[model samples]
Target: MGLGRLSALDPKEPVRRYQRERPGELLHLDIKRLARFEGVGHRITGNRRGASQGLGYDFLHVAIDDATRLVRPQDRRSHAMAGLVQPAPAAC
Candidate 1:
């Protein structure tokens, strides 16, 4: 279907941005998993010999305050729910 026809069939609501009044009023938490790598990759080495495999992944937990735009980031070896339950360390 054409873009114009699709929009007419299903109209989308107007986009709205929400902002917290206070610094601690709202916090957005997100987790990202990054692959673990050792030494240089084949892209640079031009060879796949001795490539590291099954090294596991690292999880990065990020928290952002809606009002103040403050960010808190934490790195963890695993992405377990238990790790999130615990408070992030004081040091970033």
Candidate 2:
């Protein structure tokens, strides 16, 4: 059978030029702060609960490979009561 038009599937007509790229060629970085639901609460007996109380944030720095599309995330949080104030964009 003959090959059909690639444009029919993807209107963008994207190319696979970067498919064979190597790692570190492209990286993805972001912050994944902990939601309020994932926070810990205190007990009424003047004792701390299982985890920290209130909402907490964790900075999740991620890196990706342009070719393999592999992903790597890094946790940059000291306290569970902290939040990510500023977030940077991923690059390729």
Task: Please name the candidate that would achieve the greatest lDDT relative to the true structure.
Answer: 1
After superposition, the stretches of candidate 1 with alpha carbons farther than 4 Å from their true spots are 1-15, 77-92
What digit string (tens of lDDT, one per residue) describes model 1 on residues 1-82? 5666656778679999999786666777888999888888899989988888899988788877777777777666554545
| Candidate maximizing TM-score | 1
Clash statistics: count for each candidate: 0, 0
lDDT of 2 by residue, 2-92 (tens): 3387656655656766454554545444556555554334544455646645655545655455565666555665423122222212332
C-alpha TM-scores of all predictions: 0.64, 0.39
| Candidate 1 lDDT for residue 50 | 88
TM-score between model 1 and native: 0.64
Q: Could you tell me which residue pairs clash in candidate 1? A: none
lDDT: worst 10-residue window of model 2: 80-89
